[model samples]
Target chain A: METGTAAHDDAAREPVWTGLPPGLLKMRRLLLVVWLGLLTVVLGALLNLFAGPAWAAFALLPLALIVWGWVLLGRNWRSWRYAERADDLLISRGVLWHHETIVPYGRMQLVEVTSGPVERHFGLASVQLHTAAAATDATIPGLVPAEAERLRDRLTELGEARSAGL
Target chain B: MTTPGAEKDVPEAAEVVREQVPVVERRLHPVTPLRRAWAPVAVIIGWAVHDPNQAQEQLTRLTTITLLIGLAVFVPAAGLYGFLTWWFTHFSVTDTELRIRTGLLFRRTAHIRLERIQAVDVTQPLLARVAGVAKLKLDVVGTDKKDELAFLGEGEARALRAELLARAAGFAPETVHDVGEAPSQQLLHVPAGVLAVSLVLTGATWGSLAAALVVPPLLWLATHSVWTVLATALPLLGAAGASSVGRFVGEYDWTLGESPDGLRIDHGLLDRTHETVPPGRVQTVRIVEPLLWRRRGWVRVELDVAGSSNSVLVPVAPREIAESVVARVLPGVTVPPLPALSRPPRRAHWCVPLWWRGYGLAVTDTVFAARHGLLRRSLALVPHAKVQSVRLKQGPWERFWRLAEVHVDTGANGTVTARLRDAEEAAELLREQAERSRTGRRDARPDRWMA
Candidate 1:
C-alpha cells in the first residue's frame, strides 16, 4: 500500500485530557525559586567582587528567567495532561511550543514507577513507560504514590496482554 | 529497576523435565581464571626487567626469599578468587523461565519469562574458540539486560540455544532439536575477501586503524623511546589491533538466511557465530548505504531490536538483496515515490543546511519513510503501529523562514526527524502520523502468535 487515508479528520469531539496533579505546580515553583535564588545570590556576590554595584543590575537576568519560569511553570503544568485511550496513552505537555506523545500498549516493554526524595516528601511519584525506543520522555509526573503504583500495574498488565496478544 | 522474581505456572510436562534436569550450574571459561596467575607472572617479570644489573647486584638473601614468599601467597589467593567466582555465577533454564543467580556475598537472582525472550545469539571469541567453547547470549524483548551463559561446550551451547528458542516460540520440548536444523533459504553472503577489503575502504574503520597505527609513533615522540612507554603503548597498540581483528572475526563470512525459527544469521570466519532472530523480534529496520558503497550499490541493513541499538543484519550487500531483507522483516513498508518535495515554498530552503541535497519522505499506506543523508544515505521505516510519538520542531531561524521539522520517534531507536521548509506541512504530517498510529494500533492484532 503506497498511500492511506488521513485518520484524524473525522474526530467529532476533542480527546478527553486529564491534567497533572496541582501539587506539581507548587513543587516546580519551589524548586525553581530556590535554584534561582541561589544562582542570583551567587552571581550577586561575584558581581560585588568583580565590578561592585555597576554590575548589580546584571543579576536581573537570572531573576528574569526565574520570573518567566515561575509564570510558565503553572502554564506548563496546566498544559500537562494524559489521555488514556483504548489502545494508546497520549501525553500532552509544554506551553508556547506544545508536544504530544502517544505510547501504544503493545509497544510498551516495561512500566517503571519511581519517587525521588523530593517527590516522596510531597507524597508524589512518577510513572515511566519504556518502549523498544531508547529515549522515553513520556513520563507522567506528580501523581500520588498510590495512584502511580496503580498506573504502573495497569500499564504493565496492559503491556503484557497487548504485547503477547499482538 | 525491577526484577521478575516470582515464577508463574508452567506446563506439567515441562515442569517435570526441569526437575529431571537437576538445575544445571555451569562455570565460565578458564581463560579468565588462568589470567589471574599469568598477571602476577607478568608483574614478576616486569619487576626483574626494571633493573636487571641492580637486581643481580642487590640479590640479597632476604629479598630473594621475600620474592619467593610473595609469589607463593599471591598465586594461591588469585587462584582461590578465580575458583570462587567460577563457583558462584551460575544460570539454570526451567520450563517457564531462565534463572540467573550470581554474587558470592550479596545474592542476586534474575528470572526471565520465556514469553519475553527475543533472540538467542551464539558467539565465540578467538580465545574461547581455541578452547572449544561458545557463549550463548539471550536477548529479551524490551529490556537492556542480556542473559548470557558464557564459555560452554559447543554442543551444550547449541542445545541450550535451541531449547530457549523452543520455549520462547511456544514449541514443544521434543521438537526443539528438529526445529534447530529447520531448512533455511540463503539470502546473502559476503566472502571473507570482500569483507576485508570493505573494512579498509570504510573511512571510519580505516581511520580507527590508522589512528591505532599512528599511536606508537606519537608515543615514541612523547616518551623518547622509553621502556615504560613500550609497556603502555604495547597494550594500546595490541588493543586497537585486537579490536579491529575482533570486528573482522564477528563480521567475516557474513551470511543471512531465513528459517522456521526466524532470521538465521551466520557470520565470522575464525570464530563462527550462529544467531537466531525470531520473527516479530525486530523493532525497526534501517537500510544504510555509505558514500563509498553507493557506487557498488551496497547497503548495510541494521535492526534496532529489543536487545541492541544497532544490530546489523547485513554489513554490506547488494541493494536488491538488502531491499528484499527489509521487505521480509517489515512485511508492508516501502520507500516514497521519486521527485521529493521541499515544502514551505522553495524560498524557505535557506533555513535548511543543505537545500540542494534534496529530501525524501512519504506517508505510505501503513508506514512513514524518511530517506535523507548527504554522505551516508539511509532509509528509516517506521510502521504506523510502531510510532511512539510525533513531534513538530520549529527553531527560531526555521520559524522566521516559515519551516519546521517533523520528528517521528519510534521507541528506543533514534528519531527520523525530517526538516521540511513548510511549517503547516510539518504539522499536518505530525497530526496524520499520530492519527494513523492511533488507528493502526487499535485495529492491528499486536499478538505475535496471531500473526
Candidate 2:
C-alpha cells in the first residue's frame, strides 16, 4: 500500500503532457513537400536541359531530403508537448535537442492568439505567451481555433488572477 | 486588486485633478545652450584648425575662402539652433506626471507618469561641471528610453530628484517640498589606485599585452619583416593602453553608499555620475574575479538594475568587502560558496570538457546563484523574487551527454544561467525555480515602496 501511494505520487509529479494534433504534422509535411517539390522539379528540368540529363541526379538530393524531413517533422511534432500545472505552464519541444520553458502564471504579461492566412485556412491558431523576459519565447502552435481561443482566455484569466510585479 | 466601487470614484478623482493648481513651466539653466552647442562648435573648430595661411599647396585661395565661409556660417548657426531648442523646451511637474514640451517646429509633448519611474540619476558631464549644472535622467518602467532634463542647477536637480522619488513612492508633490539629501551612510569605497591596478591586471589587458609580446616575435621569425611586427604590435599595445586609461578615467574614486531610499553610486573623474539604485530594483548582482586579481584577493561587483543599463557596483574591492556589498545590495539573500553548489555529473563534462568544472548552481532560500568561468571567475546572484521566467535548454552534444542548461531570467537583460548540468537536475531546477519565483514575488514589497 505504501508503494502504491509512492507510485501515485511519482505520477502526480509529472503532469499530463499534451502533444500537438496530427493535423499540424500533416500541414507542415504538406508545406515541405510543396516547396521542396517545386524546387526539385525546376532544378531537374534546368539540369537536364543545360548540364545534361546525368546532372539531373543532383536534383534528387532535395527530394531525398524532403522524405527525410517528412519523417523528422512527424517526430518533431510528437516531441512538441506542453503541460499546465497549478502555478505555471511548461512547454517542451525539439527532436535532436530539447528545451523546456516554465512561465509562471503570475509572470505572464500578455497572452495572444494569432492565426496566419494559411493556418486560418486549416482552421488552426497559435497561442503565444509573453513574459517580461524576452527570452521566454513560449509559443503553442497549430491548435484548433476553438481550443486556441479557450487556451488564450484561460491563460489570460489565470494571468490576471496571479499577476505579480516584475 | 481593484475594488468594485473604484470605478464610481473615477469622477471624484477627476474632480481632485481639476481642483489642483497648475504647476509653473520652467526652462533649463542658461548654460544649456553652451553645453548643447559645444560639440558641434568644437568639431567645426577642429576642422578649421589647419591654418590655411601656412599650407601653400593644399590650401588654395578658393578652398581657404570656402573654409572661412563654412566656419563663419556654421558656428553661429549651431549656437542659434541650441538657443532655439532651449527656448522651445519647457517642462512642468504635476502630482500625477512630469510633462515636457520640446521641439521647435513639431512641438512634441511627453507625459511621464510618476508611478512608472524606476530611477532618477543626476549626472554632471565635464562641461556641465564647469558650468556648475547637472542633468536629471528619469528611467521609467515599460520603456528603455530615458527622459532627461539637461543642465539644471545641481542643488535644484537633487531636490527635484528627491521630490520625484518621493512622488513615485506615492507621496504628493507638496509633502516632499524642501527635501534635502536622503539619509545615507557610506557602505564601501574603492580607492583610485586599486581601480587602476585592477584594470591593468585584468585578463583582457594582460592577454593583449601577452599577444603583443608573443605574436610580434613569432611573426618576425616567420616573415623576416620588421614592418609586420610593428604593424601587429602597435595596435595591440594601443588597445591595451587605451582600455586601461578609459576604464581608469571612468571608474576613478568609486563610492557606494546606502540610504533608506536605495543604494547610491558616485563615480567617474571627468563626468561625475550620481546613480541612485532604488531599493528592490536590482535584478541581479555579479561578482567577477579575474585570475590575476584572484591572487590579490580583489573582485569587481556589477549590478543589473531594472530600466537602466548594467552598472558596476564596485570597480575593485577585497573579496570579503565585495561579498558584504553584495549582501547589502540584496538584503536577506544568501549565496553559496563554489564547493557548496550543485555541480553536474562526470559524464556531463563531455559537453564542455575544458570548462566543465567551472559550472555550478546554488539555490538559497531567496537567491539563485550560478557560478561559471575558468580563468576569470564570475558568480551571478539573482533574488528569486526578481526572476521573470526560467528556461532549460539542451544542444545536440548536450543531448548526447544528457546535459542541459538552466537559465533564470530577470526583467533586466542579464540572466543567471547555469550551463552543462545533468538533464534531470536541470528540469527539476526549472520546476522548483518557478515555484520559488512565485513565492518570492508574493513576498516582495508592494509597488509603492516608500508608503
Candidate 3:
C-alpha cells in the first residue's frame, strides 16, 4: 500500500473516463512477455551448460518477476487514465502505487507527436507536452496517429490562448 | 504569466512596425573569428603532434610549406569561414523585442519579446573572459528554450542586461546604466572554513565510494593491506577535494545586492556571473538549515525562477542572513503561520518523527507556505497565482489511518512541497487551492516582463 503522489479526489476516487486504444494493452503484454520468454530460454541454456541443474535455480528470480509482471500488466494498463479538462489535462497511472500528473493547458509550451516503428506498426502514436517545469510535463501514449495529431493541434491552440494566464 | 506587449490597448500592426525599427544592431567582437577557428587550429596542432619525428625532421620545410599552404589554403579558408560566421552573427535590440540572426546558409533568427524575458544570465567563460566578451541567455516564461547572444563585449553585456531588466520593469533603460552607484546590500559570504568543510564533505562521499570499489584488489595484492588502502584512498580523496575546490573557486566572491530592476547577484571567482531575478519571476523559495550548522544557526536560501535553473540564492549563511535574503528577493511572501497546521496524526510518529511536529501549512490572501523538518527546518513560499497544480496523496498505512497529504506545484522544477495528512482535509485543501490558483492568476498583477 505504497502511497503515490496523486492530486485531490473524492473518497471513492472513481476511475477516469478516458482510456488508450483497446489494442494497446494486448500489444504491450506481447512485447514484454516475448522478451521475458527469450531471456528465460537463454538463462536456462547457460545455467545448464555451465553449472548444471543446481545452479539453474538462479533463473527463478527473473522468471518469477516476468510471470508476476505478465499477470499484473493488465492492471497497469487499466490504471493509465487521462482526462482533458477545461483548463488543464490530468494524467493518472500506476497499478499498485498510483501516481497522477496534472499539466495545465496554459503551461504547455510544445506539443509533439511521435511514433516509433513498433507503435507505427500498430497504427499508434504518443503525444508529449513539454513545459517549463519538467515534473508537470506529460505524455499520452497509445493513440491513433490521426488522434495524436488532432490532440497536438488542439492542445497547441489552447496553449497559445491560455499561456498568458498560466 | 501575463503576455508581454499583449495588454489591453496594443494593436497587432503597431508591433510589426516596432519590429522593423531596430534600437541597436551590433556585430560580435573582432575576436569572434579566432574563436570560431578553434576547430581548425586544434586539427592543425593534432597533425603536428601525431608524429614528432617527421614533424621535427622536416620542421623548416614543414614550416615553410605548411606556412605557405596555411597562408594559401587553411588560413584564408578558415579565416573566410570564421569571418562569414562572425558577420552573420549579429544581435539587435528593438523597443519591444531582441532579435538575434545567425547561420550563413540556413539563416535563422530568434526574436524574444521584451516582456517575456524571465531571467537574464551573464556568463563569462574562460575564452570569452580572455577576449573581454560575455554570453547572455534570456529565459522566457513559458518556453523551455533560451535565447542566447554569444560574445558580446563584457561592458556591453552588462549594459544590455541592465537595460533589458530595467525595460522589463517599466523603467527608463538609460537611468539604470547612468546611476553608477553600487547596489544596496551584501548579504552573505562563504567563509574559507565553510568552503574547506564543504570540500571535505564532498570528498568524503565520493572518495569513500571510490576507495571501497578500488581498494579491495590492492588489499589482496599488497603485503600491507592497510598501507595499500591508505595509498589508494589518498589519491581518490585528493582528486575529489580538488574538484570541489575548483567549483567553489569558480562560484566564489558571491555578492547579492538590491537594485531597481530586481535582487541582483554579482559573483564567480574566475569568470563573473551576473544574474537578476526580475520583480515577479521568482516562483518558489526554500530555506534550509543543515544539521552541522544547527547550533550556529546557519542556513541556506535557494529559489527557482521560471524557465531557468541555477537558483542558489545563498550557499550557506546564518539564519538571520537567510531570512534577510528571503526578505529582499521575495517581497510580500512571508513565513507560514503555525496556526493553520493541526497536530500530526498518530501514525506519522514512526516514519517522520522529527518532521511530524514541525510540519505546517498556511494560506494567506496572496501566498501559501509550507514548513517542514526539525533540526534542518525548511519553509517553502509560493504564491497562489504561481500554483501550476495540486495533489493529495495517502500512503498505504496513511490510507489505513485515514491520513492524506497535499502537494502544490508552481512550475518551478525540483521544488519540494509536503502533502497534508487527514484524507477529508487534504481533499478540501486541494479543491480550495485549485480554485484559488485560477482566480489568483486572473486577478494577479502582471510580472515585470508582462507589465
Residue-level lDDT of model 1, residues B327-443, one tens digit each, is 777766554534542323565557555642556676777777777776887777777766766666666566677677777776546677676537777766766676686566665
Native-contact recovery for every candidate? Answer: 0.43, 0.77, 0.27
- Put down candidate 3 lDDT per residue, B1-451, tens digits, no spaces: 1123442354565455455544667897777787777667778779887887787776766556677876788777888888898898888776557788888898878888877766788888876888799988887754433357777888878778866766666543324355343355556667766655654444344655576567756675765677667767677666655566665775577777776566677677777888776666778888776566666666667788877757788766777767777866666655553476455666766656656887777777777777887655677888777877665556666666666677776766644465536667776676567667656777655765434
What ranges in model 3 sit over 4 Å off?
Answer: A1-74, A82-86, A110-129, A137-161, B1-24, B34-84, B103-108, B124-133, B141-150, B170-244, B307-309, B337-346, B349-379, B391-412, B417-429, B447-450
Cand. 3 TM to true fold: 0.70
Positional deviation of residue B423's Cα in model 2 after best superposition, in angstroms? 1.9
DockQ agreement of candidate 2 with the native complex: 0.66
Which residue pairs in candidate 1 have backbone atoms (N, alpha carbon, C) closer than 3 angstroms, thus clashing? A132-B411, A132-B412, A133-B411, A133-B412, A134-B412, A165-B447, A166-B446, A166-B447, A166-B448
The regions of model 1 sitting more than 4 angstroms off are A1-13, A17-86, A95-98, A108-129, A140-166, B1-62, B87-90, B141-146, B177-180, B206-246, B333-348, B355-358, B411-413, B438-451
RMSD of each: 6.9, 5.8, 7.8
Candidate 1 at residue B160, lDDT? 78
TM-score of candidate 2 relative to the true fold:
0.87
Residue-wise C-alpha lDDT for candidate 1, range A69-157, written one tens digit per residue: 99888887887898765556778776556565667666687788888999989888999987766655779999988888888888787
lDDT (Cα) of model 3: 0.70
**CAPRI category for model 3:** acceptable
True-vs-predicted CA distance for residue B209, candidate 2, Å = 4.8
Model 2, residue B174: displacement in angstroms? 3.0
Task: Using TM-score, give the best candidate's number.
Answer: 2
Better of 1 and 3 by DockQ: 1
